[model samples]
Target: MPRADFPTPVKNLIAELKRLPGVGPRSAERMAVWLLQNKKAEPTALAEALVLAEEKIISCPACGFFATAEVCEICTDPKRDETLLCVVEQATDVLPLERSGAFKGRYHCLGGKLSPLDRVSPEDLLIPQLISRIEAISGEMEIILALGADVEGEATSNYLADLMRGKPVKITRIAQGLPAGGGLEHADELTLIRALQGRRDF
Candidate 1:
């Protein structure tokens, strides 16, 4: 006879959990068991929160950051510097920079980097929106490329820099050789601060 495993419902929960990033089969099984068996684990509350987030959270059209309102808090903040625009790979990248407290400027998330292998092109990202935002700015602005030091990030940065070559904006990239092969999410506050302070012209 075949050995019995988790019930169908429990197995289904584990399978769903496995779909989450960085979660393997064993981790998902453990999480599923904990959620079903642990008294402290409020599965209903968790489900409700997830549903609420999915229903309410939307990407800011202006800067591509997560927001409940039409515009994100950063874009509407009067204290942030309008003259500086930090370009990043994704919405998740914005928080690390914010936590560093080094950049008081606005942000533009590209959504993803250019990768030939991944078939992600400039058109696949928010490049057109980025151009529109740059054109909308009146005075001289500095665009800081805060992308990773990975190959795809480098390609994306170069592409953006070349595209904005004749524009009035000054282009710079965060100091590399530090965050090599890593995204901003992996960086600590001090490292991010140093990178921002040590930015160089692209």
Candidate 2:
């Protein structure tokens, strides 16, 4: 019979890794073993990187997207059109749209959508900031609601539309009947851009 020995520290590391999203127990154990077997300073660097990311990275004040500094790169970019703002649920949702090379407007990341069961309220999102920005815009701007076509997404779009009533801005929602409940992060770049181009008024 062969005896097995497992260190407490290694077990702790594996458990911690398993806590991460999409990382199962087997994958976590493999990662922990890899970290131990690798001679380089990668494990230490990985720990440092995780700590740094959590401590330094913050939500952009204006857009509710991730930003290392006070403002996000897109918000500070002068080339983007201020007269147009595309509203999305998460920060990663912007990538597909950006890759399509179709949109020339700015983005407002809501951080998340309206999910009552998830205890997500409008106050929990960046909706107030969006309204303030709309009010402050010197000229009429077009608000493009780019949320997914899920039930919650539809509710969010309707809420925003009602909020923008009497405002000088034009409100629009991305086209439907494509892929309902599909996240922008998962959508192909061409499809997302086409949706943006074919947006309909809300």
Best by TM-score: 1
lDDT of 2 by residue, 128-192 (tens): 99999999999899999999877898898889899899999999876643477778878776677
Give candidate 1 regions above 4 Å deviation.
177-202
Report how far off residue 201 is in candidate 2 (Å). 17
Deviation of model 2 at 150, angstroms: 1.5
Q: Against the true structure, whose lDDT is highest? A: 1
Q: For residues 65-91, what per-residue lDDT tens digits would candidate 1 score against the true structure?
A: 999999999999999998899999999
Give lDDT for model 1. 0.93
Candidates in order, TM-scores: namely 0.87, 0.81
Model 2 worst lDDT window (10 residues): 173-182
Error of 1 at 163 (Å): 0.5
